[model samples]
Structure formats: structure tokens, C-alpha cells
Target: MITFCRKSFIKNVFNGQIRCKSANSVSLSYNKITGCVTTSNDSLPPVLIFHGLFGTKNNWKSISKAISSKTGRTVYSLDLRNHGSSPHTSGTDSTLIGMANDIELFLDDNHYKTATLIGHSLGGRTVLQFAYLWPERVEKLIAVDISPLPTIPQQFFTKTTFIDELSKSIENISNDLNMSSARKQVDDRLKPLITDAFIRGFFLMSLHKNEESEKLFWKFNLNSIKHMLENEYINKIEIKIPFNGPSLLVHGQQSDYVKKDDYNAIRELMPNVQIVSIPETGHYLHIEKPNHFIDCVISFMKLS
Candidate 1:
């Protein structure tokens, strides 16, 4: 189980007084669902937003707020197991099926009879499985930059190697005088590979205080994350039920994650799926291009 600061933290972050405690809890039983945040307005159906590998609820904060304000809907963002403030436990497998189960528990406990699910990367895969398992509870589905099949191991290994190297570099730096120095350390390694400020910001969120001392450390459970990466990249999950609801599959033009070869499989599983490609962007399409992402989501939401 994971312990969180509950509604108090949320209140401080949003600067708004949330009136309901029916769904407020800082700490939760499943490590994956902790640090979850929810914002609700009077008129819209609940929207569930799931983050990618090593990502937290904070990753989607800006986008969630933007979408919530525009749609007048509640957006729930959760820190998947072993990430962010979520608990690191024996159940930290990080598989699609395991992650989808986390969503199931979250929705069931919160009295959300159904919701529109939007997920990215690993999250995108989780929602697909969730819809497959409980199609009746998902009104609409959106997958951003990932598909339902096994991902290439080379990509997973490359990302893992980058994070591993970055983590070691930060840990070895003893005398960090200021934020600028700390950032410089990170930029020295990452800037060459990722020039996008938003993507870099996403990686920086993992940097935090170590429990033992003032030395900064990554919040993500790296060992388990690395372990899960190998499994997820080379495995297939059985989906007994195909989600037969309205779905939008959005991929980045520069990304090879969601390829043309996977479209037939996606369509076979999700008969009503529509695919969209955003130009000049890659894996982190939502963050790289918010206006385009929001436009796509809004257009889909307007559908009956």
C-alpha cells in the first residue's frame, strides 16, 4: 500500500476547495493508484487519464487542467504502481494486465460507473486491456502513441540504458550548489537526445530527495521498472473481449511505436477505431503539441 497526503495536497496544488471526500484518500492499498488526483465540475462525465512508464499524475497536470476547463468534465490522473507517490510493493509487475487491474480498482472504489479513458504509452496499452475486460464501463477510448501488441525490445533497452546512465550521473554529483547546476548535469546527457523542454521536464519530475539524506534521487522504482520493461516488450496478453466502443488511436508522425502493420490488429480488436497521425511530433505527442492533442480529444468527445 502507498501513503499519500490526500485531499490536502490536491487543495494546495489546484488552489480550489474540493467539497467532496467521498473519493478522497492520500494513501491507497495498491501502490499503483496512490497520489491520484481528481477534479470535478457539475456537467461532465468522468474522464480517466493514465500516464506512461515511470510517469506520475503530475505528468499530465497541465493537460488535464486544460482539458477539464474546456470540457467542463472531471479528469482523474493516477500514478501507476511503482511510480511517483504510488507505493512500491510486491505487486509492481508493470504489465498491461496488472496496470489495467489497477484502473479497475480505482473506478470501482470511486463509484465511477463508467468513464472515457485516455492513456499514453504504457497507459495506452492498459486502457485497451481495461476496455477489453470491461467494455461496458468504457464509453470511449483513446490510445496515444502505443498499440496493443508487444513493443520492440531495442526501444525498451535504449530508454532503460538512458535512464540508468542519467540516474548514475545525478547520484555521483556530490556538491550541487544550485538548481542551475543540477539542471546542467541533466542537460549534459539528455539535451543531445531530447531537445524538447516538455519531455525534459517529464524526466525531471522523477528527481527528488532521497529518504536517507539530502542527496537527490529518482522517485521511480528503477529495478522493477527495468524488470517490467523486458517482459512488456516481448509478451502478449489474451483479451477475451474486444472493446466495441468508439475509440480514437492517435500516433506521432515521427514515432515508430504505432506502425501501419498494427492497424489491422487494432481494428480487429476495436472495430470502431479511427486512427490519426500528428505531424512533426514523436512519442510524447500530447506534451509536444497540446493544442493538437486537445483538438483531437475534443472532437472525439463531441461524438454521440
Candidate 2:
């Protein structure tokens, strides 16, 4: 059985039935609707995977299936709110805490007493926030290519500037044009800002056809995400307590997101964390080195 909350909660939010004074308001009660694709086999401890920014559950489909088959544990790849098929939210509800709350509701609605969380980039921060807020609910945690630091130091470019440029490029794609032309136009505009073909292609995945208008549009809630990124996601995480559960921090050798200097700080927060670095890979380690990524996850899960 697919255990998830009814889609009504999302509808209510979209209809303006739920309102809050601030983004930090705790009175908000409706479940933040999310989309997930799962591979199950009546497994005891399920693994929930969360994708990074501009990514959806589809990005992790093959990985989730492989993990499920090899480890004999159910694997779920979730589309965080405002991304993929998940419901979009605005204002305070788009913050990191809000995202964590959504995950909490997901677990509760599904009757999952505890789960092992695997998150990449933005999703990594979400799972970390979730574990911090509700340590008892997480059996384990795996953060990929992200640090628990207050701000993300620049690697490819300034994070804010990069996202803003990318957003503009996406917006520049003409809606009236055919998908192929729009893609070409988007690529042309993004070429100067983003030189890497792989990264540009990754961002392009968010583009989809609008059924009514027959136009290509972004599946993600770009405005909401931009707001969150500026106000919360890029800032330092405020955590009250550390998650003592078994934790794994995986980084790519070619990635600068997780720096050597940050290890002590990460250890201070997650004492049980074991750090692993995959060679010759960048921020998207899972995509660049799927076999190594899968092996690391499986090996970690098998540990007694």
C-alpha cells in the first residue's frame, strides 16, 4: 500500500486556506505535500532519498532501485516541496524548517516510526535539519557533498550569483517557441554563465511542457526556491541539538562543498559520522560515480 497523506493538504495550502504571520510561525499545521517514487519489498528499515536543488525523485530512480535490490531494504526517492511533482508553497512555508516539517509529516502519515535518510545538496541540509529537530525519528543519516556550515563557500561560482544567473537564463527561454528551440535558446543564454555541459543539462531537466499552453516551463517553483535560498538555505543552520545516530558524510574529491577544514565542525555536530571521499568526482558524486556511491551506502548500511 502506498502510505502517504491525502493530496488535500496541498490543495488547502494552494487555496489560501492556511496562512501564517511569519515563516518561522509554528502554528502552521497542514502537511506540506511531497511526491515520492518507491521500491519496496516489505523491508523493515526503509531508506528515504532526497534530491538536491533543481533535482527530482526521477534523478534517483535507478539508484533507489539498485539499493533496494542489493540491500533488501525498501528505498524511497522523494521530490521535495516546490520540486518535481510535489506541491508548491510560498512565504515562511518554503523555509528549511518548513521543509523538515514536511518530511516529519511524511513519516507520520506513512506510519514509519524511523527511517534512514539520504540527502544530496539542498536535500542534505533538509535531512540534517530533520535529524536535529527530531533525532528519535531518524535511524541513520547520509549527507552527500554538503557541509553543515553556515554558508556555502564558492566553488564553481558565487552560489547566489550562480543561481540568479541560471534563473534568468531559464526565464529567457521563450515560452511560445517549440521545446527544441527553447532548449537551444536556453543553452545559448546559459553557455557564458555555466560552461559545464553536464551542469547545464542537469538544470535543463527541470523544464517540462505545460499541457494547456503547450509551452516548456520549469517544474520547480523557482521563485519560492530563490526566496528560500536567499533567506534560509544559504545561511547557517540553527540546530539546537546534534543527531547522535549513525551518520555518513560523503564528498567528492573534486567537490569543494565539503572542505577538509569543516570536518571538525561536522564531527562536533555529528560525533558518529564517518566521512568518505570518492575520487575524481565533483559535487554530483552519485551521478559521476554511481557504483562507488552505491557501494559506500550499502557498506555503511551493512555495518552492525
Candidate 3:
């Protein structure tokens, strides 16, 4: 069973006073319901946000709050299973279908019969799978910075190497006695593998001192995520029926994740899809251009 944090606890997390913790024992079921940080109100058809791989609900806090206030609707930012404050399950539990089922449970647990789903990267794939499996439950769908292509072996290998190196760097940093030293050591090690400073900073956001362990560790389940990225996340989606809901696909113009060639396949699965591109940004378009991203979402959501 998933339990929400008290409002005070949620506030502490936002203020950087404490790391998020699970409020109750996590279920080991395949369709395990995950935790969430919500900006709720008595609004119909809430907007549900799902973060990318190696990301947490914390990453979307500001965005969620903004969207909630702007749209006059509740916004639920979720920590997909094995990441953030959610339960850490095996790689098999990290498959697209498994993640989609988690979303289904979340909606049911919260008494939400329908919602607008917004997801980024791996989360995007999850929402797409959810729309496919439970089309009637989705009011709308928005996918960010991802394509529906099968796993490319070379691309998979490249990402695997990066994640492996990153995990090793974090493990080494965890052994350092001094927090400052650990931070420096982690940055030094990551600088070589991740050239982009922004990307490096983004990854560091997952690093936090675990109160129980009394050591610095990644908030995400790195090993499980690595396995999922290698075996499940990159694989091609094989769904025959398309989700006929109002759908929007947002891409970062500078990112190759959603290229021109992938549009046909996207359109094939989402016949009524509207595509939007944010310029001068990469895969993390929302982070790089928040205003444009929000504008695109608002415009798409308002369309009749």
C-alpha cells in the first residue's frame, strides 16, 4: 500500500531539510504502486507527471506547482518505481508494462478515474504504454524527448557504459568520510564521462545522505535502472492498437531522441497526435527552457 507523506514532511523535502522517505512498507507486486508529491485541489481530471530514468518527483516540483496554479488543476508528480522515494524492485519490474500498471494503481488508489498524463523520457514510454493498455482512463497524453523505436544495440551499449561509470563514481564517493570531499570526488569523476555540466548537475541531484545508512547514496535504484535501460527500456514497443485520445508529443529540437524519421511511427500509433518542438534545447528541454515547455503544454491542453 502506498501512503502519502504528511504535508509537513513534504514541506521539509521541498525546503531541502530532509530527503523523502516511504511512508509505509512497499509492496513487492509486479504492479507495485509508487509514491508521489502532489499539488492537489478540488479540480477535475488532474495532471499527472512522471519523471525520466534516474530522476525523482523532486525534479518536477516547481513545474508541477506552476502547472497546478496555472491550469487550476491538481498536479501529481510521481516517483516511478525503483526511483526516488518509491520501492526498489528488480529489473523485470521496471519494464514499460510494469511501470504502466503502477500508474494504473496510483490512479485507482487516489480515486482518480481519469487524468492527463505527462511523462519525460522513460516516463514518456510508460505513459504511452498506459494509454495503450487503459485508453479509457486517460484524458490526454503528453510524451517528452523520447521515440517509440526499438533498442539500438550500439546506443544501448553506450548508455550502459555511461551509467556503469557513473554508478562506480557514486559508490567511490560514498566511501569518503567528508561530505565536501565526496561531492568534489564525485564531480571530478563525473566530469570526464559527462562533459555537459548541466547533465552532471542533474545527476548529482539524486545523490543524498541516507539517514539510516549514514552514507551518501543515489536516491534511485541504479542497478535495477541500469538493467532496465539495457534490456527493457530501449526495446521497441509492440502494440497494435493506437490510443485515440488527444495526445501531444514534445521534443527538444537539438535532441536526436525524437528525430524526423520517427514521426511516421509516432503518427502510426497516435493518429491524432500534435507535435511540438522547443528550440535550442536538448533532451532536458523543460529544464533548459521552462517557459517554452510550459507554454507548449498549456497550448496543447487548451486545444479542442
The lDDT per prediction is 0.70, 0.76, 0.74
State the lDDT at 239 in candidate 2: 85
- Predicted candidate 1: what Cα RMSD to the true structure? 9.0
Sort the candidates on TM-score, descending order.
Answer: 2, 3, 1
TM-scores, all models, native as reference: 0.78, 0.82, 0.82
Clashes, model 1: 2
lDDT of 1: 0.70
Which window of ten consecutive residues has the lowest lDDT sum in model 1? 11-20
Question: Where does the lowest 10-residue lDDT sum fall in candidate 2?
Answer: 26-35
Clashing pairs in 3: 150-236
RMSD of each: 9.0, 7.6, 9.8
Question: For candidate 3, what's the RMSD?
Answer: 9.8
Task: For candidate 3, write residues 1-304 as lDDT tens digits.
Answer: 3344433222113233333232322332221122233524465688889888777788888788678767767777888888877888787556776677677667656678799999998788888888886787899999998755663324432477777776688664455366667777788888878777877777788777766765788878878878887775646464769878999999999887887777888788899898888989888899999989998998887777
Whose lDDT is greatest here? 2
Clashes of each: 2, 2, 1
